[model samples]
Target: MATIKDVARAAGVSTATVSRVLNDHPSVTAESRERVLAAVERLAYHPNAAARTLRSADVTTLGLVIGDVLNPFFTELARAVEDEARAHGYYVITGNADEDPRRQDEYLDILLEQRVAGLLLCPTDRVSPLVEEVVRRGRPIVLIDRSIDGLDLPVVRSDNATATRELVDHLVALGHRRIAIISGPTSLVTGRERLAAFRAALAAHGLEVADRDVRIGDFQTASGVAAMGELMERPDPPTAVFAADNLMALGALRWVRDRGLRPGSDIGLASFDDLPWFEFVDPPITAVRQQTEEMGRAAVRELIALLNGRPARSRTLPCQLVIRGSCGERQGAQ
Candidate 1:
């Protein structure tokens, strides 16, 4: 069988450059790419997908690494990225980081070893090393959802603080003075900013933020369940709770059900990231909607531009707060 080395020799280019040309990578120059493709055709060479994917893998693909895929926010983001990538003649390989830095590092290393055309990451704070490694290896990367501090990579994100603050204002207007917050891991920029906004919202209203009113955990349903449990255990628990992510919201709902407590009526709930089942529940939970699909599309567009030798701004898309029954506030009832 004809191999990448054979193609490289025929094209008089490095194996890596030949691989890039084969994948139709946007980063490769037209003249050099043409030579490689011509050599590939002349040699009648075909890539062994499994082996090629490791070092000589020259496929048109984007590598996406996220903190949590099970979370609706990330899942939706992945879908958006995939859709946009395919439109540009590229496929995506996704991996979950589980909000752990070590896992993030491992995935990035693996992706680079595969010679991916580009990569997108939702990094933990521990992401700096990985970011540096990608840069060192000359990989084009776009950070998504969370920016890796101290790195100069292109970033695509939603305005987390603004959305959370708006949600708090809406809750306060509903005559709920005690609004508790359940947030995700603080290592990521989004989680930290959103949590800060929750506190700032309380401060903005001249309301005291009790330490007990906050719970920190991974954005998993189990964490939300645990946080809600802690909140309910308090002598003077909050009347309204804000679960920061869809998975946490689900957890909060489950705990609300487990304790036989009414969600919308007994303890008002507002969540971020609306899911399909939101309306089907007894009372639909309100949410701060992040434009995951649009965000993904925009990110891919920027990445493609970067690949094509165009400059791209680090983007932060806006969020829309979707009001529903869970916040104990009827819409348009001013």
Candidate 2:
């Protein structure tokens, strides 16, 4: 609770002299500097971070707002971002939008008010006016995992098309002609691109996804469970199911278990994201793993570049397909 005045009184120097010593001004005598340092240590006096940040145009704090908290993918991403920011001598404040656009905007506003040096976010909506305004004002922002349509913001995202194709082709080669997909919302770029990739891959293999075979999920577990239920209740359920994200994939697995059906045997299941636990599950899952940690670190690099008045470019990290028993023995890429 010690203030600048307390430090000044303890140091037997003027507040201006303490300020000069704290700022490392060359004019301060060695004797004054030692006194200020001793006082600071004795009182455990901490400078006002907000005031210090405002004193200079440089920002020592960064902000991260993720689209979902329940998804372990985003949680890992947040951790990676925080670690990277800390390494760069910056502190990070994270917010979970929980897939709500309104909440996403609110978090954005809060960060802006805090005067964060830069922002890294996985946007929940197609377009946010607050984000657009921030961009127009030339504030540094890096988009991660997802992006809006027209915004020209720097981004770090997975190349889902190639990976989705690999997964679908692997399933096709396994003799799964009728493939069902649990897709995320079409409103988001990741959702649209992934679904498009699935369809495109199937078409290339002389197959098609029927309207009934495609179930729309909100990128949440409950929606995944519901979608799986609907697909399973069909007169002719698919032989293979692909969930676009890990949580949905887990939801699909739960539905399969509830029916006493085993994946890789009764029905094939594949997913877009992979976790350590995925390999140890009842049937090790087949998945497309994105460079999640790399994506977070890259986003920080891009934002820092922008903060330094350098041009920030978009990044597309590749995803690798990891095949296992859950998808019924992935046949080599067709």
Candidate 3:
């Protein structure tokens, strides 16, 4: 059977545009409407009856999809999003993507099927075709934490480049010439930005980033453990190592402890994410602190603006570099 998607493709317009033309929405341009009608007639396209019925139902909810629920950063951000949503007279339904693109797509599908008003997504490394369709449909979607290339969606995230440079400078200032980094997939914006910044920072100090100094991680504890193991076993290992996130930092810490290596004296350690537990460890971890609450609130506000037919702008909040004992210093010395 001819479907709405087919009509949209044939007309060279978004499915949302086709819907607007069919429903006589005043915002649609006459040229778009004419094209859509011509394509519909040629294709004999019919919108799904069930989907139309579902979309007609009143929607007072928003969908929030996070990268991973186990990550404390995401857990805190979700709470802040929910709080802000309630204040705006809207309820939020959250889905944990668990760092999987397929799971993220499934959540997005379920949310759209339920006719949620809008979505806040912490995107995976790659964008899905369904997400492209959603964008073309003119649905309100605010990206939180991560972004995909070629998408003009509003985004709320940290200033990763500046924060990473600061972290690297600290490591260099501590007389650590040979430094290494455990980073997430380069396909992610955060991963790419941090890795680039690390290289730039090293270059600024008249140092080169050797290929062996960079280890690809999955932003998970297991990857961190493996990367740390590999780094420590090298013929000439790095004197300092930076993990891109808290979970990975924890993994690195575990590996260091299991091998009877002290963090500050034996080798330095740092992380991109700051957690409450960092302070309680034997040697506290130095980290970059992203404003998760502010990010969440900003994402909700931007999404709400879109819902109200107002223009929404992307925002990058500043990050704080918290120096602690793990990075070759006493907790309060720096």
Question: Highest TM-score among the candidates is held by which one?
Answer: 2
lDDT tens readout by residue for model 3, 1-334: 9888999999999999999999889999889999999999998887775678676864679999999999999999999999999999999999988988889999999989877899999998666887898999999899999878888889999999999999999999889999999998898899889999999999999999999999999888999999999999978999999999999999999999999999988999999989998988878889999999999999999999999999999999999999988878664455
Prediction RMSDs, each to the true structure: 6.1, 1.7, 11.8
Looking at candidate 3, the ten consecutive residues that score lowest on lDDT are 325-334
TM-score of decoy 2:
0.96
Model 2 residue 161 lDDT score? 99
Kindly report which residue pairs in candidate 3 clash with one another.
none
How many residue pairs clash in model 2? 0
Off by over 4 Å in 3: 1-57, 331-334
lDDT of 1 by residue, 55-90 (tens): 443468889998786787888899999999999999
Please list the C-alpha lDDT of all candidates, in the order they appear.
Answer: 0.85, 0.92, 0.92
How well is each residue in 108-216 modelled by candidate 2, as lDDT tens digits?
Answer: 9999999998999998889889999998998889999998899988899999999999999889888899999999999899999999999999999989889999988
TM-score of each: 0.83, 0.96, 0.83
Candidate 2 residue runs with Cα over 4 Å from true position = 330-334
Give model 2 RMSD, 1 decimal: 1.7
lDDT of 2: 0.92
Q: What is the TM-score of candidate 1?
A: 0.83
Angstrom error of the Cα, residue 40, model 3: value is 46
Q: Residue 80 error for model 1, in Å?
A: 1.3
